[model samples]
Target: MKKSRLILSLLLAFASTLASAQSENPPPVKEDFKPSVLNQPGKEYPQVNSQGYVRFRIEAPDAQKVHVSLGLGGRGGTALTKGADGIWEGTTEGPLDEGFHYYHLNVDGGTFNDPGTLNFYGSVRWESGIEIPAADQDIYALKDVPHGKVEQILFPSKSTQTSRRAFVYTPPGYGKDRSKKYPVLYLQHGWGEDETAWSNQGHANLIMDNLIAAGKTQPFLIVMTYGMTNEVKFGQLSSFDITPFQTVLLDELIPYVDANYLTQADPAHRAMAGLSMGGMETRTITLANPGVFSYVGLLSGGSISMEDLEKSPDFKKNVKLLFVSYGSRELDNPRRGPWGDPKENTAAVTAAGLKTHFYVSPNTAHEFQSWRRSLYVMAPMLFK
Candidate 1:
């Protein structure tokens, strides 16, 4: 009885100490977590806190391991801990970048999509996605003011031997005035993404609608198409040829768009812009066919130099606006172009009597947020 009493006293004292420690320092996680906005219709598993940390609850009862492919920096994603209830749950080590991010799940050495979230086309496949709400997300939000329609058209492409599909965004009042002709901006997505990226992921239509409704930009037609003409796989970009895509854009899509839509149909009223590898396409195509585009814009793409101008002498004379942009984070270890720093190249081009503009998005990397912000800034300066 004496031994029993002594053990009971020790147990009670240890419990009391643990209780005191927990009460004195609560868990660091905030309690105000909500389901991700990108979650599927009624499913709720992935949640985000005020600090942008993402919490994932996955159901894989028999799997030996489960991992989330989204984490801060180079942590190699989040590893979930299984509970007695057989649910795998974990939180990211740090907050993720704001905006839509494509991620996948690793289940027992195989890849799978999170059943709770919607899938988006990225990384050359349809992968699960989550959106960390941005402070400026209102810019792409659906507003009651006015809205544009994203029309899909199949244009004949003789070069590719198949009918190509493209989405065209006509401004709010586009159909109302049948006689009004608007300028056109041809937009391209990144390497892995296709034509739908601008519409689905980037919200190109909403960006243009908000800008037009707010009177910040002139209403125009925005066209988005697939940039990969040769089906080049990853790590094969060096062998990628731009001629096929260029032919489809200039010889096929542009003519089809002009004939089908109410466009100005002249080089002065046409602008071309792209992101990432799409930017490389913009640089190659724009320089190769200088007379075809009046306004050139590249987002996180390559830069133009004096040598390029010398190669295409008509570029300075015919081009109305030259816009270049990159996320500030991308310049951390600035990739030197053939000429020099991209910013310095823009400055040199500007000093040489050509209309040049450069913009760097703050606190973003080579993600869609940077490209979205680039379009926002370049829209107003086009066709001026």
Candidate 2:
């Protein structure tokens, strides 16, 4: 496949899997709705119950109609009916997967954010966000444990000809113990997202905090920056060039990170991971740079194939670990397209005698939930 078309197919598959439906006869939704955790203070309109169903109540008496553009299976979304009291009310047809989702309100044909919720940067804009409580919510839960800090750092990039922004997650006690050096992971966000997506939407710092509290993973630093994927429209995704962002990450960011922070500045101690389009970038850069990054992860992104091994023999010798993951909904949803099996590709790579691990996040799609779980699962295996 042409390089551009290959990425296009992956993007297409990600979109196709968003269409889902509940069982033909779902159980009755209990009236146990409460305010969403992401809701503004004292706002009770947008709520989720024990079954994962969402309820929205918006007050817009003068508006002709109000509609929420978030629905089960990414279908028609929820249509609101104006009550006599002038408040619009609606409910999702089915329960949503546990995690964060970006949605907006269409009030009288105007795009607007929900007044009752906090906005998250997504789809290249600040969209209202909602969170569904997960069964494994404690994995990324904010606890009383000592936490890592995610600090925004500006690094000069000669290739981009600008001061680029990147978020660095320094583990707890990084400041107190000045002599200790940690490994670094260069993480990238997918299309339509910038440096803040991982910390804001993915709760990466909190995830690491909870993990470290329980002694689950080694203390390390996670660096997040833009992938420069949103410049080309989805229609022109194939024409997306990796060179500009690659230079920013390789030539500029790495050196700044090494000099500014106490890090084991060697290939074996460095890692790279990304999601969706970011994964495509990770694959291209990790293989091409050889000893630059020893660990690699592709979360809901593409996978390594036998052809990849043939083209980059150094990948087998230099890289230490390769982690691949996808949401179960993206993998098994019958409505998806023929994007080929990521599992098969992962298996072929594993059989090639290179260390590889594959994972599937149950009951989720191409969203942050899958990537969160992928990070939780992959972090322990890095720098081992």
Best model per lDDT: 2
Model 1 deviation from native, Cα RMSD in Å: 14.5
> How much is the lDDT of residue 136 in candidate 2?
94
Per-prediction CA RMSD (Å): 14.5, 2.0
Q: What is the C-alpha local distance difference test score of each model?
A: 0.81, 0.85
Residue 91 lDDT in model 2? 85
Model 1's TM-score against the true structure: 0.90
Using all chains and alpha carbons, the TM-scores for the candidates as numbered come to: 0.90, 0.95
Q: After aligning candidate 1 to the native by TM-score, how far in Å is the CA of 64 from where it should be?
A: 0.8
Candidate 2 ranges beyond 4 A from true positions: 19-21, 233-239, 334-339
Q: In model 2, what are the clashing residue pairs, if there are any?
A: 4-238, 20-73
